[model samples]
Target: MWQKHNPARELRSLLSRIETVSQPQVGLVADVLEHACPRLKSTLGPNALVRRLIEAEAWVDLGFWLIGWELPDWAVHRLSCDDSRWSCAICVRGLALNWVEDVAEFQHEDPALAILGAFVQAQVRKAQGHGPSNVTIFRRVERSGAVSMGPEVER
Candidate 1:
């Protein structure tokens, strides 16, 4: 029997493929974005929302939309470091460090992508239902055989 389709895994797979900072014209990544945000579908068909946000580099807006969709009670915190990397985290409201994961905190060259990665990780954690316990971090291996401690890109 085929295993049931897992949205978290699917989202993570798509997240790994998006390596570039530019808006994608056509691909699975765009499809995943459309699938995640149903509210945008009626307003902007298919990947239009993702493309528009990426084109505008609207990281905070995208992050807010994604987090609000997944966990309405949660809030996102973001920071930009001196090394030109951006980190994003999702947490329960009123508790700055409670119930959030370092796994959700991802540093990326693009803040938008960083938020995207954090959203995916937060989804994965939510799906797994593990809260502040397991901490086995996995590094993403690129197609080029390079190992990146940061988030991986699919395309």
Candidate 2:
């Protein structure tokens, strides 16, 4: 029953709520969503709706990456172990792109982390009804010398 949780549906509903909002408002919503659900942030890169949300931010220049790689603009979702502090499992529709990036090095705190925490908490609460194993956060460190927040996941 835990697997029955439809994140896609939830995401769609959330996106629909902001459909008519202005670009800046959409970005704010995306920021909330990103903090509430980081998986959604990565997934939005490809999603037209999500792209609109990100574009509204005005500060982010995602077009460079979008055009340079010729990557299909589609949504990507992630379901990472709780220990993932910086990077997590990413699910992309067009490509299998999962890698760790130095998120902490950024000068500012990413709003997406807050969204991830909220989303994970909500999902865990829902899964409790079905007696699923507790959601565990796994902190993974990148070999590139970036420090992660929690204990490292043993390879």
Best-matching candidate per lDDT: 1
Question: Of the candidates shown, which would achieve the greatest TM-score relative to the real structure?
Answer: 1
- Badly placed stretches (over 4 Å) of model 1 are 19-29, 34-60, 95-103, 131-155
lDDT tens readout by residue for model 1, 78-135: 5565487777766566544544353466667767666766666666666567434323
List residue ranges in candidate 2 displaced over 4 A.
Answer: 1-4, 26-32, 35-155
Q: Relative to the unseen true structure, what is the C-alpha lDDT of residue 53 in candidate 2, on a scale of 0 to 100?
A: 40
TM-score for all models, in order of appearance: 0.57, 0.25
Which stretch of 10 consecutive residues in model 2 shows the poorest summed lDDT?
A: 100-109
Query: What Cα-based lDDT does every candidate model obtain?
Result: 0.59, 0.36
Models, CA RMSD each: 16.4, 15.9
lDDT of 2 at 72: 27
lDDT of 2 at 49: 48
Q: Candidate 2's error at 39, in angstroms?
A: 4.8
